[model samples]
Target: MQETPFCLRVGHLLPYSMLDSNITNFTKTSTFILLGIPGLEAAHVWISIPFCTMYAIAILGNFTILFIVKREPSLHGPMYYFLCMLAITDLVLSTSILPKMLAIFWFNSREIDFSACLTQMYFIHCFSAMESGIFVAMAFDRYVAICDPLRHSITLTNPVVAKIGLAVVLRGIMLILPYPLLARRWPYCRTSIIPHSYCEHIALVKLACTDIRISSYYSLSVAFFVIGLDVVFITMSYTQILRAIFSLPTKDARLKALGTCSSHLCVILAFYIPTLFSSLLHRFGHNVPLHLHILIANMYLLVPPMLNPIIYGMRTKQICNRLLWLVTRKGT
Candidate 1:
C-alpha cells in the first residue's frame, strides 16, 4: 500500500478524470515543454514585440529581394543567383524557428510534440548549414569574377550554378540528417523541459537518460568540419582575390574589385560571427548567463535574415537602383 504519486492524487481531484487522461495522453505523446528564455518569463510579452517585428522585417526583406531579383532581367547573373538562393535559405531558416518562438512568447504555448520538435531541429540546422554553403559559393563567385574575370561567366554558367545549389542542399541534408534520427532513438527519461526557445541539438540531447557523448561529439565534429572547411575555402578565395586586386594598375580598378565583394563580406560576417560566438558560448562558457546564450542563439537566426537583404540592397548598386526604381514607380 504505497502512497499514490502526487500527480495521480491531483488527477483524482478533477471531474471526468480529465487531468488523468491528459497526463496519460501527454505521456504517450511525449511532448517537450519549451521554457523560452527562462528567468525572463514575466517579460515574455515585451520580448515578443521585438522578435515579432524582426520576423516580419526578415520576411518582407527576403521576399522583396527574391521578387526584385526575379523581375529584373539584368540581375540574372551568377552573383544574384546565389543571392536568391541565400534569400530563400534565410527565409526557411528564420521561419523554421521564429513563428514557434513567437507563439511561445506571445501565447505561453510551449508544449511541442517530440516528432515535431525533431523536425524543427532538423530544418533549423539543415538550412543553417545550407546558408553556410551558399556563402562559400558566393565567395567563390566573387573570386572568379575578380581574380579570373575572363572565366567568370564560362565557369559559373547557369548549369554550374544549378549544380552548386544542388550540392549545397545535399551537403546540408547529409550532414544534419543524423541529428534527428539519433535523437529519436535516445530515451528522454529526464524532465522534458528545454530551457531554450527552439529544439537546439545540445539542449535536447541533455535530456537523454543514457550516454549522450556520441551525439555531443558528432555535433562538435560536424560544426568544426563544415564551418572550418568553409571558412578555409572562403579565406583562400579572398586571399587570391586580394592579390589579384592589388595587381591591378589603377587604384579605382582595385576599389571597384573590392566593392563587388563588399555586400558578400558584410552578409558573411552577419551570418558567421554570431553563429560562432553562440556555438562557443554553448560549449565553453560555463559561467555565461542562460538568457545571454538564448538571446544570442535567437539573434543569430533573426539578425542575419533581417539584415542580409538590407545589406545587399544598400551595398549592391544594381539592387539599390532597381529597388529605388520600383519604389518610385509604385509612388506614381
Candidate 2:
C-alpha cells in the first residue's frame, strides 16, 4: 500500500536526524585526547626508555635529599628546611606529568578527561610557581646569612621559616587557581586532541572555542607579576649580598661569602633559562617545530628536579659527606 512506503520513509529519516544531533552533542562533552610528543609514534617505545631512566633518577635523588635532611639533627636549619620543601615540590611536580606521559607512550592510553586535565594543569603550574617562590625565599636566606651573619640566627628562626614555607604554598595556590577555573567555563568545540604531551595552561587554552585573549593576557600577567616579582627580588637580594661580600676585609672572607650562594644561583639558572626560552618560543615563535617545543617543555619540568639533588650534593659539603657515609656504611 502507498501508506506503508510513506511511513517507512519517515521512520528511516527520523533516526538519521537524531544521529546528527547526537554527533554534534558528543563533541561538546568529550574527553581530551593528549597527543604525546608529535611525530614520535614510531619511536615512542625507544624514547620512553630515557624518560623512564630520568624519572627514576629524579625520584631517587629527591627522596635521598629528603631523608638526609630529615634524619640529621644538625641539618635542622632554615636553609635545609627550604631545601626539603623544594625536594617535596619537585617530587609532586615531576610525578604529576611523567607517569601519565609514560602511560601515553607505553600503552597509547592518552585520553584525559576534562577535569583530570584541568587538575593536572593546575598542580603543574602551581608547583612551578611555588618553586620560584621558594627560590626567592632561599635567596633571602642567603642574603641574610651573608649580609647579616651576626643576626641570621635570631632572624630566621623555626617559626619564621615555617611562615615563609606557608606563604610560598599559599601564594602559588592563590595565583594559579583562577587560571584553570577561568578556562573551564569555555566550551571546547574544536577537536579535543591536545598537541602536547601534557596539559599545559596555554596548550589547553588553544583548544578552546571562545576567544582566548583574556586567558592569554591573564597568563602573561601572572608570569610577569608573580614570577617576575620573585626574579626582581632575587636580583635585589643578591645585589645586597654582593655588596656585603665585597666589603669583607680579606679575599678569603669574600670568596667564602659569595661561594655559598653559587650552588643556589646555578639551580635557579638551570630552572628559569630553558623554561623561559621554551615558553617564549611557544607563545611567539609561529614557525617552531612541534617536537622541539614538546622537548623543551619536558626538559623544563624535568631537568631541575633531576639536577637539584646532584647540585646540592656536590656543593653542600654536609650533605655530600652524609650521603657518602651512608653509601660506605651500607657497603660494609
* Top candidate, metric lDDT: 1
Whole-model Cα lDDT per candidate?
A: 0.87, 0.85
Clashing pairs in 2: none
What global local distance difference test value does model 1 have? 0.87
TM-scores, one per candidate: 0.92, 0.91
> Model 1 residue 271 lDDT?
88
For model 1, how does the per-residue alpha-carbon lDDT over 182-244 read when each residue is reduced to its tens digit?
988888765666778999998987877789898999999999988889999999999998899
Give lDDT tens digits, candidate 2, residues 160-231.
999999999999999999888888877776456677899999888876767998889999999997767988
**For candidate 1, which ten residues in a row score worst on lDDT?**
6-15
